[model samples]
Target: MPDAVVSGTVYDGYGREAGGGLVLEGGVLARVLPRGYSGEADVSGAFIVPGLVDVHCHGGGGASFPDDVDPRSIRKAIGAHRASGTTALLASLVSMADPLPAIRALVPFCESGELAGIHMEGPYVSPHKAGAQNPAAIRGADPEELAAWLEEGKGFVKTMTIAPEADHAMEAVRILLAHGAKPSWGHTAASGETAAQALEATSRCAAELGFEGVPQTVTHLFNAMPPIDHREPGPVREFLAAARKGRAIVETIGDGVHLAPALVEDIHEWAGANAAFVTDAMAAAGMPEGRYALGGLDVDVREGAARLAGRETIAGGCSRLSDQLALFARRGALPFGQIVRACVAVPARAASIERAKGVTLDFEPGKRPNFVVFDRGFSPVCVVRE
Candidate 1:
């Protein structure tokens, strides 16, 4: 496609939303326009930010990422995510089996542009902190099994969700980092000490084992992970300390239910661009009230909140990425730049893709083809770009 000219308030990397414009071409940014230049999107007044990204997500709408769902269903899920403003995302497959077989199954999706990558959220988590994951599938990562999954993923696995409390978790973290997969801790009940040890191992591996990233992240700061109490610091504390030292990151599910809005503001203050908001979305996102599947069980998406189909378990399900942004904008008491940082820059930093698409995301040599028009309330009025 040729370049598309967009006119509106452009939010370049979390700064005050600009009232200028930009251009998108060939699926990349092509140009950043100035005032009084109009061609494509005549967004007289609207808020335009970079496309959003979701890391730890499950099913969305009524369809779940089950073993039986065909390729068509998965594509439908991705479309639903896009409608919610997620331009790029990882297809997070909840660990049902050993995760190797599923990784092989999902390779086609990632390679074909159906997904960004895989997020193995179990098979090596703590039975106690398993959340809604089937405990029967819980087990330490055997070297043989790990090798099998990594090989099957074939570069499609972008993130690893591990149980920091699992036996030899640190060792497995090393293996994942070695395989070019960014590892984050979750689905485990690790204490402050274990999380500390995991980040410690990450630092050592980066220094001696020739790895890249350091101080592996803690997924979902409080939920699933340990909490922090001044009396005794927990895994959350460990993550805070590492981030404070510019070593680690902390990911959060910004849905008002997963975390209190007040804490969201606090995280942005401490972690800055390191605290990322993950959808942790399941299959019920963008769908009406109904039952859905995740890994191997049924879930219910009622009144826009996902819970166990029949039980009171609040196992995460599909929720829109835009809703996360809206939650912060409404409840976080933050300005435009702060909200944009969590929605754009923060996620980019976590995935190390900031230089490519966030506020500082670099454009190709030609032009910056971009778009998105929203009103004063930040609601989308129009969006059209390559």
Candidate 2:
């Protein structure tokens, strides 16, 4: 096959180079030509980087993933992010009474590639830290029911978030690991001690199952989880310690609305590769400030923050992964490659898609052609998914 070359200041997922070109042949990245190399460049004048992957995204374009079983809504949600350089994403679902019905409906899309998979955020989480999740839908962990729902996705259930302090939470973690899904700790008021215990149990399970190097993650860290009270400490401290030691990965909304600018910089520096960024975006994302729906609840998006209608509680984010990238670029606190690592590389590895289809460790021959091009201002100029 003839090579299709795109040249620019290329950041090949891990490191950045001054100028280079990506070669694509047979629908894969044929090779990466370094600076001064002679290659006919077909695309230029932009920053070329790996396509962003969002492991935690609810919906966008006024389309809610957890609101309906309609495939049209699902396509709209996926399309919104794909257009913004999020070439891959998991369709996150909020807590619900019976998630199997929705999970089943989404299976075809997951298999068909419009969606990555399902991320069940609850129905089994701490009521104390439920945040925007429906309190009435929250329930104690039922391993049997969970196992049934896990199978309903037919391998599309990629990850599930559970509260360490919730009833039978450990059992839920066990079920998640046994079913080939990653279990993340979130939406909890669990003390640091309890969070540590949960980590210990998951560590033992991962070791026994030979899932090493796969660190346990905390969802949208410091948001639904307990805050750092000097005396109590809580999950923040424990999560940070594990992240620093490379035993855990922490997901930050990074939308600025969910975390402070300084804190985001600190986490990126402290956690490094263990730092994973997520959008946790909902229907309001990519839409103008207005009303939207998330998990059957009304949400109001104003000034770039999505909140529960008529309440002060923040529902989720109103930004895409591209917007988050622009947010980081504006700060200039971290290097360009580091920002891509947190937003793309780390999340892809966590989601087990780092070496999956349309992804490659290097811009080398025989790798699928998937990447993004951003203008100098950090806005997504083009996305090449071929």
The candidate scoring highest on TM-score is 2
Q: Assess each prediction's global lDDT (C-alpha) against the native.
A: 0.68, 0.82
lDDT of 1 by residue, 314-374 (tens): 7785566677777667664767677776766666666554433212333233744333455
Model 2 pairs whose backbones collide: 28-367, 29-367, 30-365
Residue 122 shift from truth in candidate 2, angstroms: 0.9
Candidate 1 stretches with Cα past 4 Å from truth are 1-3, 14-19, 24-30, 35-45, 66-69, 353-360, 363-371, 383-386
Candidate 2 local lDDT, 124-145, one digit each (tens): 8889988999999999899999
TM-scores, each model vs. reference: 0.89, 0.95
lDDT of 2 at 322: 87
TM-score for model 1? 0.89
In each prediction, how many residue pairs overlap at the backbone (N, C-alpha, C within less than 3 A)? 23, 3
